[model samples]
Target: MFGVGMSTAYARKLRWCTLNARFKDSAIVARPGAIRAGDRETFMKIVRFILALAVGIVIFSLTVAAVGAIGHGFYPPPAEFQQIGDRMSDAMRAQDQAAFERTQVELAEAMAAYLPTAPTGSFIFVVAAWITGAFVGGGVAAFVTSWGRRSVAMLVGVADVGAIILVSSLLPGPGWMPFVGIAGSLIAAFAAGTLVASGTRTKPSLSRKAAP
Candidate 1:
């Protein structure tokens, strides 16, 4: 009888161990699935942000192109500058590095001379085009992303300012141009972000009584 009782206890203990092992195995499997689901969600958010940024950039480029075309039409470069530009293009097409470099130097010299003497209208147009692009592009980005998210829009604005700075540096524009571009782009970005953030707020109904 004692031997039989000992055998029964051992069997119960074994059964309990088996059940516990199964529970732990199920928990381990469930945890990995949860982690994978979370990771997928995070990845999707990242993808959405990237797509938004790309769209914003494309829009910004289009805006800049349209405004720049108008500016160019209004303030055509000097004949000499145009001639040098044509030469530069030809050199590039022909893959003539030496000629390209020489033409580039000539173009730089002409631009430096002309920019100093250029009318204020030209600079105004350049700055205006960039500022407008930044505002519109940043706003669009903010609209596409969540109302609470502004990083994408702010990045678009940063791109605008960076592009302007790069162009100015390469073409050697007025010393103040970079600073102005930075300031304008920053303000535009902030305005876009503020607009989006405000959109998320609920307006109180007129019928609601004032709090005591």
Candidate 2:
């Protein structure tokens, strides 16, 4: 009877306050559906990026094949040359130096047509093929990409550099040739990538209406 002033209305008010806070907290947190949707969107972006890289590599291979076809057409090896080459392979297998020299003379005669032509064209073609491939591939990667376009393009550039180094080691050309090839490949690829990335921008749709 002494604490009667602590009435039912005050007790009701305290209970309502506690319920309100719980509801507010629940609203502040994200729903599970929204979180799942966001994760799916991120996964899709990564998939598209992988596809873009694959397309770039395919484009590079096609460019190399096209350039190689041109070289094969321009300097077609003769049937006799093929036969001599086979015989030379047989000599090496049998460890016969005498037979190797005989085949070598025939091969020299067979390759006479190419001698006067000079190997400058072959060197130019190889370099041109690499440069063109890098440019085309990097451009494609950048064009297809929406995120990290420059990074993807750089990967293509580095791939071209790796290929150039491998071929240079096998062919053993002049000491300076690999440096030139690597520089040319990286420059062409990165430049094309930068161009493509920058080109995608369209001066943000003028948000405000033009003045009357």
TM-score on alpha carbons, each prediction: 0.74, 0.66
**Which runs in model 2 stand beyond 4 Å of their true positions?**
1-29, 75-118, 203-212
lDDT of 2 at 47: 89
Q: Quote the positional error of residue 159 for candidate 2 in Å.
A: 1.2
Residue 32 of model 2, lDDT score: 72
Candidate 2 lDDT tens digits, 114-209? 444546666677777888888898889888877777777778878888988897765555565678778887888889888887777642434234
Clashes of each: 0, 0
Against the true structure, candidate 1 reaches a TM-score of: 0.74
What's the CA error at residue 203 for candidate 2, in Å? 6.3
Q: Please, what is the whole-model Cα lDDT of each candidate in the order they appear?
A: 0.82, 0.78
Best by lDDT: 1
- State the displacement of the C-alpha of residue 168, model 1, in Å, after optimal TM-score superposition: 2.8
| Model 1 lowest lDDT segment of ten | 200-209
